[model samples]
Target: MTVESAILLLPWIALVALDRRALAGDVELSTLIEPIAARPVPGEYRTSIAYYRAVLALRAKDARSARALLDAVPRPLPRKRHAEAFEYLGALLDVVEGATERTLASAAAHEHGPRRASWLAVRAHAQAASGDVESARATLRMLRALRDPQLDLASVARWELPASRLASELMRGEEHPFR
Candidate 1:
């Protein structure tokens, strides 16, 4: 990797380590967010910074901040570098905030690709949150049909991890139409 790529990769490496630590319930969200956010001009590490910031905000019950930060992420991010961002953004909108319509809309804005499975998962979660069990099940079926073993770690961490912990707390358990 080039020096620039190496430099950019370091923070995410550290973040993955920290996320693993957090998964073990040994670290605090603030501990993760402070270091990442304090780094110089995070635009170079935009997706990582944004993902962790949104995670921290959600952990702190600061949904507004999380939403703003996630919404600000630019689309068509670098194919290699942006996978986590798109995944996390979808989770934040569909699962964390119970914004299914918004998540589906956002996914629609992007051209279809392998990434669609992750997006569809979020849409499923949104549908589930809205009490549309049938639709949610269908979406999940579509997600499963993708047959892509690739998992978006960021999205899984943002949505499934928290949902496993907090259950009904992440999504409000109400249908929110796409706006």
Candidate 2:
């Protein structure tokens, strides 16, 4: 291809790369949120963008924004992977929105998927938030014991790590005395 052709393709190539990174839960993708959101996402990539934004909003404790973003995702997501991610992130949002049952159920159901670590972390959050401290501590112990090499929770669900830690400390009565 000519230099001009390559130049024209650069943006598209970048979008594809970013979309894959987003799917793989690359935390760095969060830095590109503004630029990506400002550009017009092609239909093929719209769901990924929506998912990324929704997850970001959830991490920031902005449930309203998260819900809006998730709702924008097309029903019957464009791909199976996207659908799985949608369900997982939606369950997280439900918990953040004060409905934790779905997250607990999702964590139990997807016990061995690639997202198992994330599921456990969110389950712990749900249990702790709902005043089930003992269950939350047990879930956190399970989360800590898991030896899965694929436990890259920060990439996909950025909130889980902190949420898990907070739940653990709260349950153990070890929270820092200072705010």
Candidate 3:
């Protein structure tokens, strides 16, 4: 609403508009880390940066580091981002814990819309990881059954639209413990 605020937000908007994912993997996390850390709490800017950082850690097969970022997205993310934060957090933590009932239940508690789809994908992967093929297949089928055109839109396409991404990742031998 003011010149100073507009100036402050200009860079953040540009940073988001340019597609940070285009940045090369080898660009040195240090270069971009400071900017992401400088964002304030509870907005899309902060959550998105944190999620991207977590994704990078996951890409390196470093769940421990990713966990720290995922965990910081607020325990109850103010309703707007609540489902996503919990979905990623639950799936990651459950996989780390060997997909036990406790973790699955926790993940299930926050499940919503595609968040449920993502959670199921993680659950199925965990089941397969634990040698429960039949269970995994069942869960996978359930996720597939929920498929719809809505997922193609950007509003629902957060991180490759969880369910589809998780399915493809599983098939491609990519280890995305969570979407």
Against the true structure, whose lDDT is highest? Answer: 2
Ranked candidates (lDDT, high to low): 2, 1, 3
The residue ranges of model 1 lying beyond 4 angstroms of the native Cα positions read 1-30, 39-42, 59-61, 71-91, 94-99, 108-111, 145-147, 152-179
- What TM-score does each of the candidates earn? 0.55, 0.70, 0.55
Q: State the lDDT at 83 in candidate 2.
A: 82
Q: What is the per-residue lDDT of model 3 for residues 1-179, given as tens digits with 9 covering 90 to 100?
A: 43234325654553343233322232344445455457563465666666667766755557788788888776555555545554655575556556556656655674564457556655665665566656665676566577733221121213332233445544456644442
* Candidate 3 clashes between residue pairs 3 or more apart in a chain or in different chains: none
Candidate 2 lDDT tens digits, 1-179: 43234224543455556654554456666676556556665775667767778867776778899889888766877778788778877877777777887778878898888778768877877887787767766766676577545543333233553355555464456755453
Query: Given candidate 3, what's the lDDT at residue 170?
Result: 42
lDDT of candidate model 1 versus the reference = 0.55
How large is the C-alpha RMSD of every model relative to the true structure? 8.1, 5.9, 7.9
Q: Compute the lDDT of residue 88 as modeled in candidate 1.
A: 45
Candidate 2 — worst ten consecutive residues by lDDT sum? 153-162
lDDT for 53 in candidate 1 is: 75
In model 2, which regions exceed 4 Å deviation? 1-30, 39-41, 152-162, 167-179
Positional deviation of residue 155's Cα in model 2 after best superposition, in angstroms = 7.5
Worst 10 residues of 3 by lDDT: 149-158
Q: What do the candidate models score in CA lDDT, each in turn? A: 0.55, 0.66, 0.52
